[model samples]
Target chain A: MNWMRTEMERPGQREQFQDALLRGDRPAVEEMIRQELADYPYWRDELLGELTEQYLEGAVPFSQLTVLAEAAAALAEHLPPVAVCGSLEGNPGDTGRNFIQMLFRAWGVPTLDLGADVPADHFLDAVSGQGIRFVIAAAFSADDAGAAMLLHQKAMERGIRDQFDLLICGAKLTEETGKKLQLACMDHRAAAVARWVVQTWKNR
Target chain B: MEKQMIFPANRFALVPDRDEVFAWLQCDAGPCRAAFEREWVPALQLLEETMTPVAVCAQRNANALTVFLTIGKETEKRVSALFQEERYILGSLLNTLCDEMLFQMDSKLANILQRELVSEHLYMAERLEPRVHLSPETLQADFGSLQSMVPFARVTTSGVLYPAKSMLYRIVLTGESRTVSALHDCARCDQADCLYRNRKHESLREKEKLPERELKESTKRRKRLVWREEIGIPVLLSSNASVDDNSEVSRFMDYFKLADPNDAAYGALSDRVHLLTC
Candidate 1:
């Protein structure tokens, strides 16, 4: 649908969407969203990306942002379920993990959220018990990174490194670390990772 | 004996820089820019009315500088409540902005130290440790007493800072003759958080002693390591402030009535008005 082109052509469409969402004009927002989905379903990721940007900018409240995320998730409901879980230490906020989950859901991949402060063994448990082959780990501070890296090492120790694909996202997932771990590192945006997941799944 | 000094909220301006805030909003684009202009004022007003910046500077021992910072009790309460209400995104953004504002204030403080105190080099506490000779665990343990310097901040049982929005730093001053290296070589390090820690790299030498087939497999797995550009939004350290329902910014939705919410200019004007009222 050439989402960028459409966004460029209709300069204020995103703002309109955000204003309607903020003003509690759900019907109007829903109608606009429906139109976009019906006409350019391929641009679902881009549309959600714009909404996430608004939420990050504080233009939309958390409730409204969740609603948008759910809406995006509903669009890709037909896709297969892909087990996903994330854990962060010390940080109570789960916005990054939630956003990634929503993006995965939008791509029709059902995610199993393990919540925060997850230990390395829990990730291995998910893979072994749930038959899930993909795992995502996130860390904000050095402490959180310590826990996340522990998870990576545990996965390796348990002989699951080659069995499952570990995707690390967050401030601590540097290029050097990703290279050393032999895992994929995602950008902060859920859309970017979702795109990678979609392409990888399709290619596979 | 350890020494500490408290800086009142008035000592530093906690308001965010206009350009940085706009940049954060990604307002350079046409649509987002229009929305930013509309919403900027009210957000600024809310910030000014609610925020009270406070800082504490202390030296745990003779060599290290520790600073504890927060935007006072009221804002912390407000942000905490927002999180409880499940307005996590808004709460997170405000929390992050406050941290950035504190950092700006810290930079100013550094400038003052360099100009007035004539310090040669100022090293940020987080930057200095783990990269230098000191470990975070050691510093975190040593600076445990500094928590009492600030009223709103505390150290958790895990030795991590609490009131997640609050910042605790331990900057150090060195003579010009000393060359400080902030970057850590993660590949060689055993630090758990070191992203560059190559588990296989360390074991490769040991694996060389294994059978040819096992070594071949190990080498193949190592060869698969590909570096991709690090992506993702920088994670802000989460603040664990308790929620307060009486937050002044809770009714933030009512502060601005977009005269034609769809109109870019109108939205911009409304935001400017909100900022102006502050």
Candidate 2:
């Protein structure tokens, strides 16, 4: 190899080459940045999260919002379907539910979402009556699980257990108790859960 | 096909025919479409309560639509009576009814939609409000837009939206393609560690490995690797490796590329090959 070519093969060369691809302003190299990031395993989550945070903060375009939403939905479909119920007041989980719903659509799973602040009876009624494959009971605070448990119990009582499957996920299912209940423990990484579920379900 | 609610703020309109539903949604006059959508709420209210499929139709040029619900003859009659002399309020009444009806839904049926792909978008609105009208002529000219609105998700016909969710994209060889499919449950997988494995594929030895504290946890794990019975028959759905199954899934996966012209994943299965599997 030529000495100069070998010299150009140093660690910094990749970054320099990437930088050289940009040629000038940092802002103009977004496409190059995207291409470079595409194959990076961690890039999808980081880019998605940044874009999501920006959109939620009202700093991103609606088109970008849709892209983020679609990616999230694709991820959400792989996991067990969860339904979160809570008052919108001071509860960010409800917002998370909306984001997940949009993401599920993007990922190609049709989601029937009943919005937040829903009455526990109504929630139970759906749990009792519909063949919900999974019931994702979400409560932002400690007190929320009471209602979720009641709904879960109601499903059992109504014989809804035979028809559908239920998976409770959220802030309320503490790690310690999650193990107790034998519920699938999921981290706040929504996309990760979604992807795992899809992969798991497919392999299953 | 049954209409399923996939996410929050999700709405489904059951018209006698999908074209008419799209046509009404596309009307230029905001109130005209609003009046129509508003009128359908009561009917939806009834259908949701009865927990059955519904078909709604409008009288020619009458701002009113007739709803024929199939929860049962008696329940439909009662619902019709509720609508006969009742004054309708758009949001409040519908919202309240939705709350009540959602409670009455058959959890099992709802669960089916949750577990299975149930709908496709026949039409999707790029923007909301002003009702966003696409007349019959427009739909015929570009019937494709209505395809997205199908109750099912992620189905494309010639890039046009269709209302079926029984398909998925699969990868063959190197490229990605779409296929009309029902995935086999992981319970059927030959691989023991297949993560998707649920109860249907559980092994007795694996069960014995759980610690005392983990017994309940083990029961909660989902089953894995079992393909739907229909998938095994090539006639019902083209086998993943079949020549006739040229769906978007085949095109997507391009199994041709995976062929390697030289067997790679299954050298043992190929007599001429020498790859080993332990």
Candidate 3:
């Protein structure tokens, strides 16, 4: 439990913010930001810098970006399907699943939540049995790429690899690896996913 | 079934309080305190000067220090063996440090940036956009004085506290690196039929200390030879060489297979090992 805390922002705060974001409570984020800003006047710039870092580094994608504006607008809405995975790189506390949920909501897709370290069989059962349209494999290292690869293999074995659009996103995914596997590798950018989904859907 | 074998002196329980333990070992009272103090300070100083490996450890878990100490069996055996007279003082001192409050340790946040979350930058870039407006100055001012803290506690698990019976203790250190590089080579090796051939760490030379000629012959023959327990596991070198099935080391590796070594199920492997290793 203690190790869990080291992996991310304080769990309580993170959870609250996540809840607010999911509820589409833009005002809450704005208000919380304002209060935090007031609490640490000196850290306002740094906090924003950190937030920007999160955004640019793809922790908070464009779809999730809407949460910022929506917070400003004071609207709260629920999001779509999500999946969290442990790091392939051995780094702890990645929140790509939550970010993806936010992005899927922006695309008007209802995302299911399947948490981290989930096995390949579980993923297979979920996708085929649960009618999952979008599959996002998130990892933080090259070793984690195996999880995504397993999914690819499973989908192909089940003859559904081409049926549903699949995307692999993470810090661990390499250009060569993605090209080798023919996976649609994206960083944390929701817009990139959005673009790909739109194009794939149109082509379909 | 067996009256869980207890050691002669509950050497582990001597210093119940973790903080007192750390003070004795790192500062004064430990069995190897003097030597460690003399060597450690200098090593730390040198490490700081070069900054080759990031000192990513945090104060959160005083236990992590002890856990790190036990990472290598040879290191543990050497330290544990020096447990008498002034050595006892040093050992006790070390034990004291092991008992200290992990949260009290200093967290090198810079090291976290450099080592622990090495690819955080890449994660940010892939998920978020490149340029964004930030009231950077205010945020810096906010967090400037707030010290970076580590949250994990390094408590000794049930299994790790037992006193040693054998001269050497078994230490299991696995990583994603080995499975990716070495296991792949193992799969490709001609000796795929060997039972213990599938799992090996990268770099046979590093694992196996053999001359070039023996190494070549070993590679060609694919003879899975077992080493005696005297030297620990019989290490086969050369990318991912097969382990002799009859070796004690192979037996030891087999005992741990309640969980798979490669792509363990549901990350449960890490959690189980954490509990067992402390």
> Which candidate number maximizes DockQ?
1
DockQ of model 2, rounded to 2 decimals: 0.01
Every prediction's TM-score for the first chain? 0.64, 0.50, 0.54
Question: lDDT of each prediction vs. the true structure?
Answer: 0.51, 0.33, 0.35
Report the CA-based lDDT of candidate 1 relative to the real structure: 0.51
Give the lDDT of residue A198 in candidate 1: 62
List candidate 3 segments past 4 Å from native.
Answer: A1-94, A188-191, A198-204, B1-278
Cα displacement (Å) at residue A113, model 1: 4.4
lDDT over C-alpha atoms for residue B162 of model 1: 49
Instruction: Write candidate 3's Cα lDDT for A1-204 as tens digits.
Output: 011222233436654654454343545655655433222211322332344456566454232343332332221124334322222222222244444444443333445546544566666666677666666666543445665677678778888776555676544355666775566546645345544553454355
Worst 10 residues of 1 chain B by lDDT: B226-235
Candidate 2 residue lDDT tens string, B93-115: 23223323322222222333223
Candidate 3 lands at a TM-score of 0.32
Q: Please, what are the lDDT tens digits per residue for candidate 1 over residues B127-204? A: 232212233454465456665666456654334454545555455544433333222223312234321133333344
Q: After superposition, how far is residue B78 of candidate 1 from its true place, in Å?
A: 7.7
Per-residue error at A152 for model 2, in Å? 2.0
Q: Could you give candidate 2's per-residue lDDT for residues A1-204 as a string of tens digits?
A: 011221123355344423322122223333333343322223334454554556446454323333233223322223334332232222222323543444444443444566554554565666555534444444443334555556556656776644543444334445555554445534333343344443444444
